[model samples]
Target: MTDLSLIRNFSIIAHIDHGKSTLADRLIQITGGLSERELKEQVLDNMDIERERGITIKAQTVRLDYTAKDGKTYELNLMDTPGHVDFAYEVSRSLAACEGALLVVDAAQGVEAQTLANVYQSIEHDHEIVPVINKIDLPAADPDKVKLEIEEVIGLDASEAVLTSAKSGIGIEDVLEAIVTKIPPPSGSRDKPLKAMLVDSWYDPYLGVVILVRVLDGALKKGDQIRFMQGGTQHLVDRVGCMRPKIEQLSEIGPGEIGFITAQIKEVEQARVGDTITTVKNGATEALPGYREPQPVVFCGLFPVDAADFEKLRESIGKLRLNDASFSYEMETSAALGFGFRCGFLGLLHLEIIQERLTREYDLDLITTAPSVVYRIQLGHTKTEDAQEILLHNPADYPDPSRIESIEEPWIKATIYTPDEYLGSILKLCQDRRGIQTDLTYVGGRAQVSYELPLNEVVFDFYDRLKSISRGYASFDYEQIGLREGDLVKMSILVNGDPVDALSMIVHRSVAEDRGRHMCERLKELIPRHLFKIPIQAAIGGKVIARETISALRKDVTAKCYGGDITRKKKLLEKQKKGKAKMREYGNVSIPQEAFIAALRMGEE
Candidate 1:
């Protein structure tokens, strides 16, 4: 029998909050990855921010040993995949390391847009699918209905599905048994030159570059020299280990096994997703499949809330990048916000995660600008340039177009999930945002509305606004849809009645009016009180239509120090003077700090 017969590899896949993580926790307990008393909610999601947000942002792999009801020991290589589209590419990479996927669906809510998207990806990967209906213990849960939805809509067999309530431990044993029977064992020849795929990576405070690799054709051990074929970096393996949710030293990992390798390598320049790992002595002929560097679609400028943290933010980002290679940015200086970086991300969630890590994990407060999508501009029939790859991150540095050609921004094939009752509202919302509807389908009293929207349109709180309009009953997912020609303009913000070149945004000309109004109002809320009235204006070229006034303060000053409690008044005046010092001074007014932060908190209305 092949070694595969002794090993089972699979992943747990689901949309956010559909109980994928909760079920993984229960599965780990059942399989002896953790003791019952030691189990915590979402234990597989080790990052603090992941716990706080109650969402899985990273794809993590764990190994477990289970004694079947037959009393035979079996190896389960289980991976927990991210639930959102921002990390969808990572999820696909995680799935590539497995032979089967446990497609977890919520019994009450049924299939969401991301669930469908992931299902399609899993099928495309050619993995065997095992449908697991989760949350059956809830009062509103109807596993039978969900089974029908899977059979009728997803084209899966209803009789083969397993019903489970991860909380109550019901059918958890059956799910494990399914893992042994339904998923195939990984089978690769050890006789071939060493070749493996790097699925994911993270940095340990104690250890260095920890890479998660799927051994495809050779054995790897401590002291072995390896090269990241795609990254062009080579190093001696300092250690070989396997993850039991946390890292554990291992003697070796052979073909058909998944484990961690550390080279103590520095820089994300070395650890790349989908790169091939091969023996340095006897290299493989061809790189393994799925070797491509991740390219970020969205970019924004980041500055520290306190200038003191500027260096700290940079150093923290360097460390964060050690663990997360997906974050891309370059250090730079802002005239108004001081030292900062122009960062890039796969999407909005990626942006939020980086911001959260900087603020929460790194302990640095930050200020970020509106995110911009990569643009494509043609100088002539033969000279074309990628906006993000060539254009300067600072709006003030945007090149003049009379160097003359057409420009295009990235677009996405967006799928919005909403209750049937809110279909009309969603459609109107999309149309108003300049979205082009591609398709509309009804499934089990819900609507799947597909539209083609510019990445810039949905980059900033569009999902949040859509969900709010639908009363939190809507879900959104998108994939890049190439580029299209459209009417877009550069909308600049005038702070204290002067154009702050750094705060300009490139938006579709059709939506400029609403965007202008929204931005002007948001700036007013963000700016601190000043000595004279400050006007926040949205302008295009020489024309300005939307304006908001931060009225001159009437009582912010200490009218009287009063009493020899002069210390209190002194402290107050000292703080106000410091605030005034930071504010941008115009001909007749002083602009406050809130204006810099208000854009981040937009869409609450």
Candidate 2:
């Protein structure tokens, strides 16, 4: 049995591009977890998109054997996690499995938005934190200034913080020593009934499904009958193992240890993340706490460019769900885009990742609609308690305004970190989006402001605008603040005279005209000239708010005249003009598929 006192489990947290993955590589090199030939930059970031974007998408866990300065060998598990706000749930699951955290900050950039958000999460989990400032080798690095910011903003003493440059391998040994001395060892009892938390999972053809978990109490072994309390499904363990930089079979993993279990479970949903695992025969008295099913916030419709690829799209998503369980999709049909699925995601980033994966992994051509948020509407008439409330995600299902007593939308609490010079611009942007300032503070030269903003406002090009105003110097993070009453109206677009359901959107009543005008103008640019004039109109409810017209293609009817008299040419031209007018009165305007998408994609990035 492993000594719990000599084992330490911890996670690395930081804002995106703050060198969290790079620091993990340095520590892995220092501990000799993998040989030089097997080691590479961002080793823990296994996804291609993650490596290309220089971000961590999924949390990675690996066990290391480190020899402390006191000549004692210790087991260290590094729970490398995603830093984006879209993956906050992933960060929380990682923190729950660790006894401590190494808060990594960029030496030159100081503390940003995600830095403070993740630190508070670590503190909330009651984990011991050790601040580490990375990228010190940069010419503009100011480690001293960052230490002070960490102390003042995060409320954590950084006098003992380690400063290192993962690029140059400086102070690598110091970081290892800090992990051994500063981070506390794991604490739990091995004698209790089995209680494990499933933190991550993946599917394999040979093994069916495999789950990674942290043993909160007792032990698990091969052939043990296990059951997930949240899923309520039982299975006999097929194999028990550990990731020692590579998979290695083990007889049993005791308390406070991180390991894997493949229990002949075919479905990934049965071994969901944040669920508790226990022995089916001699179960723990109760399940572990803090298990929550992921609730999707952003929604969109995805359809294939070719109708025959519908089955292929379904198969691809099923494979993806084997790895990503947070995203949900159902069969949905559209008049403009054809048959597709209505998919739900945690946020915009999550939706983008899933769509990109389907396109790349499955080699499928997909058409996606504009992303939207789920809405809560209170109907005017109700026969029962359940009948009073209704949830709507698609704009096509919107009811009459008279029937809706009130409409509510989701709101979020956002934390923005930016330089003091751009504070006024950011404040103006937030106020324009209906944000209510809750707290404002300054840490050294940086301004950290907190505001409560509507989810629809933030999800619509807010991040892009924040970067544009700050010139890429600002970082932001947010959490859902629940739904509240909103003055929202469904806006529709028309091509010629026909309404397009795919171009429908929900917008605030105050800015309806402005948003409508922009949509009509943008649609005019994307639509090609037809035989007859095409009118693009944007309407809120039954009232038209904006309009634009695209002129038809003109043809030279008298061009074939061969030395004809001037009277003959004039008569021919006049006759052709009348024909054009008649066609415009009775002919239909054919709009390109791209025009339908362009209207909904108007306004901003």
Candidate 3:
């Protein structure tokens, strides 16, 4: 076994597109973990969607062997984490397993919202942070300026920060040297009882459940019986290994070491992330502190385009749940969309990723409803203590406004970083969404602005509009603040006098009319014209707020009456009118799947 002092556990933290994965590639190459032929860009990002989007979805870990200037071989455990706010939970869990973190900042971009957010998390975990200014090869790169921003904004000293171009091979050795000299080795004792932290787990077809763990106290060997402290489930460890970007078998994982173990556990739910694992025979009396459960911020309904695919959709969703514990779903039947599932996600991006995976990976066509945030509804007008409270996920389930004493909607504290030129428009956008500005400051050429906005307003197309207004130069990140009282109402869309449950949404009463009108107008353009005139209306509590009418297709029934008397022509027209009215009364408006998809994708234009 290697000495504890010769091992270092650290994670790379940065904003999206700040080169965390690229830096990981260079480190793995320098350490000889993978040959040049086998090494590629984003080697740690294994999913197809991740490579396509040029983003890391899942946090990946690798063990590298690096020989330092002291002529001593050292084992480095590196956790490469995602940079998006939606995957911040993954970063948190990864940091909990490491004693130090490498903070990467883009030299040209300077400090961003996510950069500040991630640094704060590392600080909370009490990690020793090594600042690295990356992308120094770019023409616009200003390492000195970024160093100052890191110091001013993140409150981390950057005077001794390493400058490197991860894309090229410059300053790679200095980074490795800094990690060895600056970041302290993990502390643990092998003589104590086995106490391992379950960092993550996933499903493997052949191996069943593959669990990633960090040993804190004693060594974990193959063929040992392990017990999970949270679930109280015991299993026999069948294999122990570490990922050197590829699986390498290990006889045992000693104290302060990170590795993976397969215990033939059939389901991933049994192996909870952040749970304590120990020897079943003489397990530790007290359990390690577990992670806080991830709360879903946005929710929407996902329905298969074809009703016959319900079973297939269920199976696909179940398989996905095996890997992602943050995503939650429940079966629900909709009058308009038939059978479907109401799903909850951490954020809008997380919801999008899951929907895309359902379509691309499972080969199923899906229709997603408008995203909504959770709200707390007080049921009665009686005293606050006596009134019952319910959490509302879907607007269709929204209780009557008269019955609800008050509604409390979730709000978020948001931080936005943008170039000075776009600051005015960004502020205006936030204000339009009912935001309350908390603070605003200037960091060099960029403006750092913070606001408290309702989660309902930010959930729908806010990110898209922000990107467009700022010309893609702005970065935004947010965390949920507790619910606040809001004057909100549920607006339902009715086609031919029948309410469409999937199109209903909760909106503030002040903008309900404008929002309702926009929805009606969009539906008018998307829904195909039928033989009978179709009337679409947006209503709240039986009161119509907006209306649109799709005029019926005209077929000339009087054409055959050419050269006839005026009375005959008039008679034929009257008959046609009567038939149309009857059809309108009895006919069911068959809304095509595309119409639902397009209508729900509002404000994209």
Candidate 4:
């Protein structure tokens, strides 16, 4: 029997690019969890996109038996998480599975936007935090200064903050020692009914649905009938296993342990994340209360570049969804782009990664429409009865003008951290985006500013602009602040008098004209010149805001003539002009598919 007293379950939390993944790699090395040949960079991060982007996409759990200087062997479970703010929900789910967290920070950079957000979350979870200042090998490493900053900003005792360089293997042993001493073992009783927290789950072709779980109470064994309390579904446990960086079949696992369970489930929906698991016959009466269905904030259309590939794209998404439950899609059609799926995502990076995976893993080319935030549009009582209100997720679904009484857009409170020098530029950029400054403070020569801005504004180049203004020295984190009334209108782009739904966008009424003008001008450059003039116009509710024209293709009238008199040349020129006029009278302009895509990114710098 394993002693519950000698176990520590904790996760690593840090800002993006703060070396959380590398630190995880170092810990694996010091513990000798895997052989030298078995070791590689970010062993826990399993995705190729994650490796190439140098970010952790999924929260991976690995178990290691670490022998401490106290002459006792301890089981340490490390749940390394994604650093981007988009995965905040995932972060919370991973934290709930642990009793403590290793708060990692960049030695030179000190505290960042996401670092503070995650630290606060850890505090809320009541997880014991062991601060570790990483990247001490860098020339700019300032452990002492960062220690004070951690104390000042986070209110945590930084005097004992571990200083380590993941690259040089410095202070790796100390980090392990701190984890054993500082983080308390989880408190639970194996005598109780089986209760496990299913933090993540995915589909395996052979095994079907495999769930990553954290045991909170009792014991889970193979062949036990289990019930997903929240899902109200039961299954027979097919396999019991743990990831020691590899899936090792285990006979049984007790409290404070992290492992996997193949429950003979065929679909991902059966094993919803954050749901509680218990024995089917004598399960706990109350399910865990933390389960929440992930709500996607950013939405866009994903259409097959080739219309015939729609079914393939749908199947590919279905397979991927079995892995990522947060990613969602529904069948949708566009007047401009044929049948497609309207997909929802956690954020821009999540959206991009899924798109990339679909293209690479499934070998399917896709046409992705411009992303949009959900809007709440209220309509007064109809002619017959009750008031009508609509929640619009796609711009193409905007209702008629007369039905819209008011529009409300989602807003978020964004915290931006940067040096004092770029305050002016940051201020201007926020104001232009219609952001309302809520608070500003200075900490250790760095400026921390908070703004309440529309979610749509942030989705559209806000983060990129913040980095550009601060010269790449800024970090930002935001949380939704609910919806508020806004003067918003749906602006549409017309090519050759035909509306292109993919090019439509919801913009503030004040900047509708400016945005329309920009869109028209951008379309003029992107749309090819046809035999007849093509008119590009932007309008709101039938009111034209801006217009541009792609001039007709012109040919040299005398280029093909070898030798001709002046009269012959004049006659040829007149005949050519008459033919062009005739063509213009009856011909229709054909706008290629790529033009619509180009218009979506034309506003981006």
Instruction: List ranges where model 2 is wrong by over 4 Å.
Output: 382-387, 556-586, 603-605
Model 4, position 221, has a per-residue lDDT of 92
CA RMSD (A), model 4: 2.5
Lowest-lDDT window of 10 residues in candidate 2? 596-605
The lDDT, on a scale of 0 to 1, for candidate 4 is 0.89
Q: Per-residue lDDT of 224-274 in model 4, one digit per residue for the tens?
A: 999888889988898998888878999988887889999878888778889
lDDT tens digits, residues 1-605, model 2?
78998899999989999888988888888888889999988998888898998988888888889998899999999999888889888789989999899999999999988888889999999988989899998999999999998888888999999988888889888888888898898878988889999999888788888899999888999989988898988889889988866788899989999989898887787777899999998888788888899888999889898889999999999899988888899999988888899999999889878988898889998878878899999987645433378899988888877788889999999999889999999999999898999999988888899999999887778888999999999889999989999899999988877888888888889877887898888888888888668888999877899999999887877788989689989999889888877887787766666666555555455
Number of the top-ranking candidate, with lDDT as the measure: 3
In the range 312-385, model 1's lDDT, one tens digit per residue, is 98898888878777878898776677888998888888888888878888788788877888776555432574
Better of 1 and 4 by TM-score: 4
Assess every candidate by TM-score. Answer: 0.90, 0.95, 0.97, 0.95
Q: What shift in Å separates residue 576 of candidate 4 from its native position after superposition?
A: 7.9
Clashing pairs in 1: 526-594, 526-595, 527-594, 527-595, 528-592
Query: Which residue pairs clash in candidate 2?
Result: none
Candidate 4 segments exceeding 4 Å error: 555-586
- What value of lDDT does candidate 1 attain over all alpha carbons? 0.81
Provide the lDDT at 559 for model 2. 83
